[model samples]
Target: MGLFDSFSQIRNILKNIDLAAVHKLSQKVDLNKLMGTVSKMSEEDLAKMLKFMQAGSGDKRPKPEVNGDFYDLSKTLSAEEKAIQLKVREFMETEIKPIANEYWNKAHFPMHIIPLMAKLDICGLTYKGYGCAGKSSLLEGFIAMEMARIDSSISTFFGVHSGLAMGSIYLCGSEEQKQYWLPIMQRMEVIGAFGLTEPEVGSAAAGGLTTTCRKEGDEWVLNGQKKWIGNATFSDITIIWARNPEDNQVKGFIVRKDNPGFKAEKMEDKMALRTVQNALITLTDCRVSEVDRLQNANSFKDTANVLRMTRAGVAWQAVGCGRGAYELALKYTMKRKQFGRPIASFQLVQDLLVTMLGDLTAMQTMVHRLSQLQDGGDITDEHASLAKVFCTLRMRSIVDHARELFGGNGILLEYDIARFVADAEAIYSYEGTKEINSLIVGRAITGESAFV
Candidate 1:
């Protein structure tokens, strides 16, 4: 071979080598000696090597981002609101994305992020007074979407604390209770959890109230097992709902974790949202002071008020999960080569992307109006229920399509789509099952209860 041909062969081989591995090799080997050897190469060979290195090195096409807000819903926010939305997005991307898979794999919560998360000052985003931002419901919905976009488990954790638990106090607590809890919980100085679903009950929570509470003197005695209480295992306080056996009315109590009778055993082997520390709580003779009771929560009607508010947030979360999966799949298909070109160029693949985007856009628009209804004081139980029902069902379909696009990698946790897919099932089941939410809407539209 000619002198130049030999150098060209060496340069071709080097061009295909992984730069990351080459950099690591240079670190361990004598770098000076390596450069010394390279110095002897001809100017022509050197130029070829440098050119090939530049072509194959780390610079890549700008990564396709995972955003499902196709209609520019974010543009509707004011400048200040958009900045805050971006701030939360940046936090989730930088802090949570790196460790999310590790924590989810181990089924452990990263309590260390609490301080960092609290700094966002988003815990009580929608309420007025007591250190809250008093933001619009649309902004709150956007915040929920941003959290679930990166990790649904984290979103669930936030919603349980901010929406359900703190919301119980906001809507149902007395002035004294609100003054004491809202400020700290809003700051996330004290994490909270909602304890409503029970071991014997899941969907029929409103009427089935199996957990019982009885008043004795100044304290109320609570006895019941609450299952799937997200964040309950470590939350400082959990809002437990139990039926007043005397009146057959449901009431809410703030059960502190330190209380002797409030026992929380971490549930094990969950397939989805593993990073969320859900617990099977045994409130055996749990003693709660009347002062801790939610003074305004008169019955199941009151609990529904809280659910009616938070269910809209859950629908927003479903949009986030679907966005994560759809973005992953879109990026994957665009990069994955088959038949000598990117699969995303294929018609069928484009069809799938279109389908996923259609569903996502529909969800985004629905929740946007749902928030408007809430902000306008026109939101009803059935309105929230319908949004939850439609969004979650569509989210399941979107995730399934995204996972199918992955072929084998869809089930692998490393790809992140698997996490979204697994978490979608939990989102589908929780807050309220599709059947129940659908029945709620059915009753509203038909003026007939189909629940029985």
Candidate 2:
């Protein structure tokens, strides 16, 4: 090898030494004098000394936790919030990690784990009563990130039940309705789903829901199709939104699964988020009792209230997926060897890793502030829309960069990065598409409507 290459190899070997060993060595010998003596040695001699040091120091220092929270955002959380964050992380790593890929590959939900999840007591976590935790939105966002770090589909399943479906009832349901449904759903005894996106209306759902509702004496009949209803296939209840035919205004109803007119079929053959039980729902003459209608959800604006909260959850999910991918890449680079050294020892590989970490830190800090706004009651639709748009875009980029770091193994599901790659796409499209979310912010800032 040339002299330059020899010097490079010597530097690489020295960089891998555990720093604690150097500290201990300073106590035994004068570090300054020792370094001065070493300065006269050739690269070959330096390499020999490095091997000796490494052999002695292998067990002396523990590597830091493989984390993507570059700015330590979790530390900013209160003690209770921090505890809940760790609790959820432990749960995901212990329970979900083992079966996440298996369930994803089979496109099936693990129904048996529901009880274990309920014991976590996280459903409807942000609401005040009905056995809910009444926690701040910041805690809720961190918990969402923890779950997505392990599995995005499971996070989606929880977000729909806790944020969207339950939030609708909590925000718009009558006092009786909240008392009746919130307690059971909070315990997850009754699973919930949200049905708002339709086959023809996704980004245009605000003004374009094809579903219609008509009041007939004591019952209101609903007729329409809802596509991509999360948790609906086997959920005990679903929150369906339809337009009032008389006034052209939107309304919400809590539709029980076994209602004669309610039908849900599992959507099959998905490329991403396969473990989430998304369903195609048909409400044909679906008769809902007057009492079942959300007492306060008289207009589409009520629906927007629920979406505003859930959109933040989506942004946090994107952060989790990106964080998971970046950490996986970091771990892989440390072990996978290319030229008699770990790939991570190379400078170019480290540059990529740093870039991933930078993007992840930005996304993490952004969501942290978003959650704060939500808890402080200062959040707007535009606040959530900005995060939903920017974070998901950064998340996609992080996953792409992480996948490239894995090289050929990136495509293999067994290695884990492949799952994050596929699942991030699902988070990207759900909640609100990038274009739709951008317009929400656009209209807020410029006071001009760009949405068509």
Q: What range of 10 consecutive residues in model 2 has the weakest lDDT sum?
A: 54-63
| Runs with alpha carbons beyond 4 Å of true place in candidate 1 | 1-66
Estimate the lDDT of model 1: 0.91
- Give per-residue lDDT, candidate 2, residue 248: 88
Residue 63's lDDT within candidate 1 is 60
Residue range 21-83, candidate 1, lDDT tens digits: 879988899967976787688777777766565566643457656567778989999999999
Please give each candidate's TM-score: 0.86, 0.88
Candidate 2 wrongly placed segments (more than 4 Å): 1-62
lDDT of 2 by residue, 73-170 (tens): 88888898798889899889999999999999999999988999998889999899888989989899999999999999999999999999999999
The TM-score measured for candidate 2 stands at: 0.88
